[model samples]
Target: MIVDAWFTVQQIDEATYAISEYGHWEKVHSFLLLGTKKAALIDTGLGIDSIKRITNQLTDLPITVLTTHVHSDHIGSHGEFDSLCVHEAEEDWLISGIKGLSIDIIRKNIGRDITLPTPASFNPETFTPFQGKPTGLLKDGGEIELGERTLTIIHTPGHSPGHICLFDKSTGYLFTGDLLYDETPVYAFYPTTNPADLVASWERISSLKGIYKIYGSHNTLGLEPSLLNEVKIAVRYLRENDLAKFGTGIHRFSGFSVQF
Candidate 1:
């Protein structure tokens, strides 16, 4: 374990680590997976502080940031990395910023709710999400090889048109992004969200085989693979009752909930 004033670094395994910001309301998590030849960083955390300060001490290997989506909270520290990869569907959003999301709202969300001392550099009033060109674009079924550890990209839209989940085949670890997580409801009611695609994505990930553990972008650090079964039941229930749409409110399940 590596202790810091801001980021909480937990080693998931010999080659993987979860870089988390627990002081913020969102409790964002960014993963670091090291391989023989290179490394992969999954979604940088809220840019309240420069995440690069922490990552620099973690590994010496070159890192390629794999964005889960283009949301402000998830891609906050994207500007710190040299190589960035985002889904093809959101190339414009990554380069030019999301069209409808207001910076005031973003400032409000990132500025509020804090339990730890923030860096002096973090001024919520002037805080801005990173925006630039992606080094590459990700697509469904794409494989990112980090030496012996290969990651499979699952295009699980609904949370956002470009929301994706990463699967580490060797470890059976599924990083579900915002598409699935416990506690606060997974949101899909925004103008940019698609509820139908969200439920379909739930159904798709629920059927994945050999998922030993599941990791979401928020809340609890990791989840049991059995949670996927509950997702299957939730998916069926949502479809059976036609509740997967905007203004449907919140649908609670055994371990998680989704808002449409």
Candidate 2:
């Protein structure tokens, strides 16, 4: 196991690892999946410290960074990677930055709520999220092949216009990004979010077959596949009660919660 001052690395399996930043209040998690030919890094953690330092110690293969959405916390360490892939819907946001989201708010969020010491190199006052052209754009049914391993992109837009979830058929692991997580509410109440689309996305993913485990981007690291059943029920209830819209508050379910 590799140890660091800011990031905590945990092995998911022989070829997969989870790089987490527990010092931040969000407790963001970034995943690294290694294959015979290359590797895939799913959403870098908060840029409080360099994620590349941790990744460099994990694998020697080339890494393709897959952005879940254009959120600041997720794309914090994006500048450190060469090959980046984002959903087509967020291609503009990735290149030019998200519209209307001020840097002041971003700085406040990044600077506050710290449980551990950040690196001396980090200065939230001057912090900026990475903005550059991605090497490729991902689509709903796009497939990324890493030697014998394959990852299917599920365009689960709602949390963000281009928010996506990755499904690994070989291992039945669903990387839900911000679409699902435990402990904290999966929110879609932002101006860029669509409550209806979010609910539909939840319904879409809940019906997926052979999901062995659920790995969300924040909060708890892994969830059982049974939580999908609750998502199914929550979807029906939210739609039936006409609550899939803004200002509905947080809807708590058995294992997870959502804010519309």
Candidate 3:
């Protein structure tokens, strides 16, 4: 394990790591998957600290960032990396900041509920999300080959238009991003979110062939693959009851929950 003031690095395997920030309310987690040729960084943590500093110490392989979405918290340190890839649907947002979202609101959220001392380099008042052209755009069923290991991208939109889940073929690790996670309600209530799409995404992931472990971007680090069974049930119930719509409030299931 690697220790740091802002990020907690946990080794999932000899070549995989989970870099988490527990000091923040969101409890955001980023994953580093190393392959024989290169490494893929799932997402960057909150911009309060530079994640590159930690990545530098982890591996010598050239890093390519795999963006699950274009949300602020997830792409906070996107500028720190050179080769960045995002879903084709969110390519515009990566080039230009997400529209309709006010900087004031974003700043407020980033500055609140912080339990650790942030570096002086971060100024919440001036905080702004990264906006730049992506080096590559990914699509559904896309395969990212990192030498010996290969990751398949599943387009699981809902919480965001381009939200995606990465499935590592070698490890059976499914990185669900914000589409699934525990401890906090998966958000789909915002104007940009789609309740119907979220449920559909849940159903899509539930049907995946072999998922030995489930890893989300927030809250709890890793969830049991059995939770996908609960997700299937939740999706069926939500659709049958016509509850997949805006303002339906929070729907709680056995191991996870969603808001819309």
Summarize candidate 2's per-residue lDDT along 181-244 as a digit string, tens digits. Answer: 9998998898999999999999999999999999999989999999999999999999999999
Runs of candidate 1 exceeding 4 Å displacement: none
Q: Candidate 2: what lDDT? A: 0.94
Q: Which wins on lDDT, candidate 1 or candidate 3?
A: 3
- The total number of steric clashes, by the backbone 3 Å criterion, in model 1 comes to 0
Query: Candidate 2: which stretches are off by over 4 Å?
Result: none
| Per-candidate count of clashing residue pairs (backbone under 3 Å) | 0, 0, 0
In candidate 1, what are the lDDT values of residues 77-103, reduced to their tens digit? 999999999999999999999897899
Residue pairs in collision within model 2: none
| Superposed Cα deviation of residue 6, candidate 2 (Å) | 0.3
The 10-residue segment with the lowest total lDDT in model 3: 1-10
Off by over 4 Å in 3: none
Tell me the tens digit of each residue's lDDT in model 3 across 73-159.
Answer: 899899999999999999999998888999999999999999988898989999989999999999999999999999999999999
